[model samples]
Target: MSDYLEMSLEQLQKEHAELLAFNEKLDRERNGYRKYAMKYAKKVQMIESLFVVPSDDHELTIKAIKTIVERVGES
Candidate 1:
């Protein structure tokens, strides 16, 4: 192989490896975000189930608001 061709091949291989590493890092971040989203969804679902009332009462609405405020404050 010519000297120039060998050098070019090495550079390409290095770039390929860097791209692969970057892609893996992105995959890890995406997975983490997915897990966090699922957790947040579950928390919201729980809160809704706990506070949702059958009647449209102002006091009940205020209580729900307070509950949410307390929950957020704890977090």
Candidate 2:
């Protein structure tokens, strides 16, 4: 913050522009992940619906699906 205060107008302007560009890039990436999460959630819901019977196997399957999705997102 002190560095910015000492910077000339042109330097500050350039720094501001660079920061804005980086922020936009982050926003784009965040939006992409949000879309992916929504799609994956919908798919999980569909799979859950397919298993009408409530049993240990069904619970395990759902847990497995959630874990896989989480791992994939991390990658």
Candidate number of the best lDDT: 2
Q: What is candidate 1's TM-score against the reference?
A: 0.59
| lDDT comparing candidate 1 with the true structure | 0.71
| Model 2 residue 24 CA deviation in Å | 0.4
Clashes of 2: 0
Inter-residue clash pairs, candidate 2 = none
Tens-digit lDDT track for model 2 on 1-75? Answer: 558778999998999999999999999999999988887886677567656766677678778677766664454
Top TM-score prediction, candidate number: 2
Write down the RMSD of candidate 1 (Cα, Å): 5.6
Candidate 1 regions off by >4 Å? 1-7, 55-75
lDDT value, candidate 2, whole model? 0.78
Residue-wise C-alpha lDDT for candidate 1, range 15-62, written one tens digit per residue? 779889999999999998998787667657756776555656868766
